[model samples]
Each structure stands twice: as C-alpha cells, then as structure tokens.
Target: MAQTKQTRGACAFCGRQMTGNGMVKHLSACPKRKDTLGESNPKSGKEEKIYHLKIQDAWLNDFWLHLEIRSSATLKDLDSYLRSIWLECCGHLSQFSTKGHLGEEIAMDSEVSALFHPGLELTHIYDFGDSSETLIKVVGEREGTPLNEHPIYLMARNELPEVETCACGKPGAWLCMDCTESEDEVALLCEKHAKDEQHQDHNLMPIINSPRTGRCGYAGPADPPY
Candidate 1:
C-alpha cells in the first residue's frame, strides 16, 4: 500500500506550518507551550470529555478532516476554525443548524456540549450567495489530550486529490473557466499551457485547497498565524 501525504497545518502557538500529524507532535512539545503541557496530558484527564468531530464538504468526499475539540467550545469557535482551515473566502456570514440546505438557524454562541453528541450531525453554511455547506458529525467522544490554547485541533485530513494533466503531460493546476463553459472539453491545464495563445483571453482559476474551489469568487483563505 502507498502512504498518504498529510495535509499542511499551522501550529497554534508558533505559527510554524507542517503536516497535520507533525503539528500534533509539534504542539505536544512546543517550547513556548511547555508550561501548559501538564494540563494537556491525556493521562491527567481521564474523566474529561472531548468531542471528536468528522467534518467535510456536503457534496465532496475528497475534502474532509477529523478534529478534536473540547465540549466547552462554542459553535463560534468551531466556525472560526473551519473558516481558517477551509471556508473563509470573504467576510461572509456563516451558521450551523440541523437544517442541511438552509433552515432554522442555531445561534453561533451555542456550546458543543449542548448541541452535539456521539451520533448527531449538523450542517454549516458559509456565504449565502456562493455558499459552501459542510456536514459535521460527532463521531465519538473520549477522554484525551487537549489542545494547548487552541479551541480546535486537527487530527487528520485527506491528501490532495490527483488532478488531470495538460495535453503536454504536465499536471493541471489551472482551470480555464471560459473553456469549461463554452467548449465541451475539460479546460484544466498546467500553468505553461494556461498561457497558450488559444487560452490567452480565457479566465483562469488556480486550483486551491478549499471545497469552494472553482466557485463564486473563492480563491482561498488568507490564513492567520494560528
């Protein structure tokens, strides 16, 4: 079997970016956070409950993540975390609720303990106009080590999906939007091919890490230090 490459994650304390699993180990012994290590030790909190969340784009299975969060964390905190990792394209309003495709809204301030459990699922909507919906499930709960200061901790995420290649045999990283709509053929191309005379005037979009890729004005996230 082949090994899967881990997704990139930024350490909450030092802002150093590494693989998601690497970040976990990095956070465990980050010198700046050593003083708080005792509080995060799993052995010390056998009775404390943590929520294990499985989150993904509602329509795409390729983009997903496993996250562990404290039950005390508010939905707003989860919202912020999601935006930082996957959804924040603009300063658009977002919400979480039982409704899958827009329905009764739950307040952002709701606590995870109040709204989530071992089997419950919820939907999150970001940007009503060019919205992206995420399906969140409380997969399970267990006593475990907690994140130092960060409200959310990434445990795992899917590796980058393989994309089509250009006619010249290089990996495709740019999608020609105009060709995709007007021409019947796939418009994906490598950066070199994207500059070809045939596609000179076509609008090209760079492939990115978000589920909102190729969607309304969603280029990517301007990730913060955390």
Candidate 2:
C-alpha cells in the first residue's frame, strides 16, 4: 500500500494551495483578506454581516468546506449552494437543527441573521432514510462586504480523500461492497479493472466527490445553478 496523499486547498484570498488546516491558519493572516477586513461598508448601504462557516461530513472529516457568506442570506440559499456543490443527488429533503430544539427544525427559508451567531453550531441532514449529515459551525461574524452579494462564497475546502492505487498505479475509482469478509482483499479498482468477471455481481460503486457518495442515491451535483 502507498502512503495516502495529504489533502490540499487554495486560499480564497491569495490562491496559494495548502492543506485544509493550513488554509484555516492562512486566512487569518492573508494580506488580501486583511485589507478588506478593515473596510467598513459596501456601496449598497444595506447593513451586512459576514459569517464564517465550517461544514463537514458528520461521518468523515475529510469531506469539508469553509465558507464566507452574508448573514442576510436564507437557509434556502445555503441549501441551494450545498446541493450545487456536494449533496444534491435525488432532490431529497433537508433541514437544519440546533441542539435542544431538534423538534423545531428550521426550514430552508429561514434567514441566517435570525438564526445564526458566532459560536453557534447546527446539524444539516439530507435525505431521511439514507441520510447524510453535515456538522456546521458559525465560527465568526463581522460587518459584511460588497462580495457578500454573492450569497455563498467558498473560502476553502478539503482536498479529495486519499485511496489505494489500482494494480496499474491508477487511483482507485470504484470500491466493491461484496468483499467485506477479507478486509485486506477488498477490491479497489480503476475503471478498466472493475469490468472483470469477479466484480460482476459485487455491487460496484464509484468513488465520488461528495461525502454523500455511496449513501442513498447521491452521486454529487452538476454545476451550480447560481
């Protein structure tokens, strides 16, 4: 087995690529971001608030994203963005919930300004049966910017998860679900190898970009409609 490659991402401010944690550290010191942090308001004049968000798969920390968005935006906007970027597979229903208020779930139309604050954490569950849960935290908040008009802006994201290489050295593109008895012999195959007779009835699943991959009917989204 080869060593798994570390995940990397580009700084939204400088476009310099670094590890997930590295980008978090870099954003605090990014010169470009710093310059904007000092500016007061955008010409639009509507009061704005910048919210820093950290989102990750409830089951796997490797699939995650850091975002900067306007507090005025609605959960619907966030839902749309999330669907576009990762979770939209079968038009499943989703919702956000705070700790004790689980029964009082917030709908997609809920405004961020009304429900979120620094230090607040929420859970997002997509699809009721084969659900994909995401842990979300509102890490910071400040006066917003002209860029806030973008609804949702991606600041950083985890690099793709690492996996074993195929016999030919190509990265594994499929994982066979039928070989669970032999953990060491579990099949991780590239496209060409996946077509072999041994894998015909094994229920092959493609490795994909979303944390929802291999769950329910999710297979990642098309381009963002925004």
Question: Candidate 1: misplaced stretches above 4 Å?
Answer: 1-47, 182-186, 197-201, 221-225
Per-model TM against the reference: 0.74, 0.80
Q: Highest lDDT, which number?
A: 2
Off by over 4 Å in 2: 1-6, 35-47, 100-104, 167-169, 177-186, 197-204, 222-226
Writing each residue's lDDT as its tens digit, candidate 2 over 31-122 gives: 98777656635663466877888887776777778887787789988887887887888888889887732546877888888888988888
- Where's the lowest-lDDT run of ten residues in candidate 2? 217-226
Per-residue lDDT tens digits for candidate 1, residues 76-167, read: 99899888888776689999888576567899999877877888888999998978899988876756567545667766665555666777
What is the alpha-carbon lDDT for the whole of candidate 1? 0.71
Extract clashing residue pairs from model 2.
Answer: 76-108
Clashes of each: 0, 1
